[model samples]
Target: MNKWLYRLKHAWAVILGKAKISYVKKGGFSFRDFTYSENEIQFLNSLKIEFLFSEFGEQRVNGGGADFQDKRTRLDPSLTSLRKYFPNAKYTVYSDFDLKIDGVNLIKVNSPVAHPEHPRYGYRTADYFKFLSLTESDADFKCVLDSDMAIVSSDVIALIHLTRKFGFCVPYNDRQLLRQDMIWSQDTQPIEDESLGLGHSYNQSPMTLWKDDERGNVFYKKCAEIMKKDPSRSSLVMWKTAWETGIYPYILPKQWCLCDGNEGLGEEVILHVGHEKIKEYYDQ
Candidate 1:
């Protein structure tokens, strides 16, 4: 869909008090369908932080059907809420298309690998761009956020402080299970086993922070190596490497970044609404 027409429809939906917008595949809707308020833009410009998000046009199921018709719609509210919460921060959207949001900057980036298919996770090539951005971004402190979540609190500023002090942070989570033999294979799991001791579990990547210093640069280099080995399994590889390298992520408190309907929605910093079906639970 042409970006302007989608924005028009989105505006109409808001004027009608409808939070959910019906999206049909190829309906000319993009992630920017939910626009930001002028005040929101002003607020974002005031913050000195930078945020990164990535999106692909439309993903198809294994059989080539529209897997989730409302996936983008489900993401709209979260993105809208993030804009409201972090008005002063710089939000950069990385995608193949040039996206425009009132308070967001869109950067056109190419996939690092051909077909960038995750062998095990089935994620699209676009999903791996965050790693590239982490390495190349000039921001002193950069945050990569999933489109499926919203920041419900200003504690993110505190989180940034913590990341700056620790060198890196990800939503505290468990170590990913990997095959024993695959542990040493870059094509399977890229990080050296020694690095896994930093943390035994994979910090969920739904929300993560990276600093632009020595530690942060090392993390980015590791991520790049892992992605080159297996673009499709980059997330898993990252978790594995972080654990093996003893570069475990500083886990964010649950109250700060809850996922899958953990609770305390009113006080949490972020709510990661997993998928369309799960999002309905929160929508209610």
Candidate 2:
């Protein structure tokens, strides 16, 4: 399986680089299909920080979907709200509608490639890479957060401070039951990319910080090779590689980074509310 996936990753990367493949949506999360509760939108408005809302997919005029069809409809409320927060912060969104979002600049591409690393079919490191490209002129540092997040006043500053002080920031979460063993051997559970060399921060969503010193283009290209080999093990492989390569300096005991999985600390600013855990948090 790893070998097959590796071959696929290699093929995906090559095809992506050369502009060879077409990005077609199979079933997955689409932001346009999601509705932002007023509370979530209001919370985002309260943050009072300049941020961009990244949206992918066609704009849905009125929400409707075909039954038994994978076709997704558009919802622009998030983008609508994002405009409120970062009005002058280069407001725009991208879609394989025929271009790639590389940070602030949108580049037209012939082929719409899938970034297997991200859960979203169209979202890629390239988009954030594009965001980082704008760092020189405006922001001292940029923090990437997911649209689903409900950003409050504290998060805007806390995330900024974390990245500024630590040189890195991860979601405020903790370790979960590793559904498999941390150390991988074929006899043990299948080992993945973490062994190949990558960062353990893959699980951190909505807020990944890449400094000017770290070139996301180079890092993601190298990491994609490992992800192709084993999609499931990609996170571990990326972490293992990052540690071995020393791409980013470490700050740990793992506690200071705010592991939000098992424990919730009072001071933790951002609330993740991932797709799986959204119901749990929403119900509460």
Candidate 3:
């Protein structure tokens, strides 16, 4: 994408300002909107589902702050919400410190994947551990969301159905245009034969969903195999894998990745709090 064209697209987006998911910003996240049949819920529950979350206790927020590792708390509430909604789903946690949450699979990584000394901040700031679910597990379905996510009130059952129907289910970059470089670098892309670039789904990998079968993980295993070329390009690995598998991504409603930057547009099912902006919960 040319720099000028990208800017023009962004300018048009701001001018149009249309987002699909709307946050019920007055009182609370009304679960009333979730109206599914028992059979539908049962069918969803029957499938093996896994949610991946990571919080490095020792990992500092790139720059200095009063509460550097404050995002650790982000997992508890988000996990609670997920459990309340999707009780049959399995949860996985990857952290450097000891976390004693019941029914949640845990992995101990010796260190955060962040490399602050490196020139590229993507390696330092990217949620690299989240990709572990893709590499380490073989559940029927897998999910990994961003740390900034304050609330996930989306229709989980429907999204699961969509994942089964489609290949990768994820949200769009509604607030801003994510650069192409973040998805794939020209020099370090791992796929030998194909380019790892996506046109329809922007910032889709951060809040993504996919599935595997008895055969094994189709997308992630490929990424793990080629990650050695440059592990820093996590999203690049995913894009490459998706491209090769022909399992293109399904772009969810833009509001799933909504933030303060795009409030008042409509109701939001998934809200990502910057922690730097509101420094609090989704108190609506």
Each candidate structure's TM-score, on Cα atoms with residue i matched to residue i, is 0.63, 0.46, 0.65
- Which window of ten consecutive residues has the lowest lDDT sum in model 2? 61-70
Q: Best to worst by TM-score, what's the order? A: 3, 1, 2
For each candidate, what is the lDDT?
A: 0.54, 0.36, 0.53
Q: Candidate 1: where are CA atoms >4 Å away? A: 1-47, 59-75, 114-124, 174-199, 203-207, 243-246, 264-267, 276-278
* Model 3, span 1-284: residue lDDT tens: 47588446545544565312233445343332333344456776777888887666544342211232444353644576667667888888777777657787778766433344565434423345555465565667777775445455545555666666675565674422223555433324333442423333245334444554312255545655545444555555556666667654567775565644555345455655543332233452
lDDT of 2 by residue, 53-118 (tens): 444554422111112122221212223333433443443333335433333444333223334545
TM-score of 1: 0.63
Model 1 lDDT tens row, 60-167: 332112133454442354567655646556678777665666666778766665444445332434446666666666766677766666554443455665776777
Q: Candidate 2 or 3, higher lDDT?
A: 3
In candidate 3 the C-alpha lDDT for residue 48 amounts to 82
- In candidate 2, which residue ranges exceed 4 Å CA deviation? 1-88, 91-94, 98-139, 172-189, 192-201, 214-234, 248-265, 274-284
List candidate 3 segments past 4 Å from native: 1-32, 59-74, 111-126, 152-154, 175-201, 204-210, 213-216, 224-228, 233-247, 275-284
For model 3 the TM-score comes to 0.65
Collision count for each candidate, in order: 21, 29, 6
Q: How far is each candidate from the true structure, as Cα RMSD in Å? A: 11.4, 17.4, 10.6
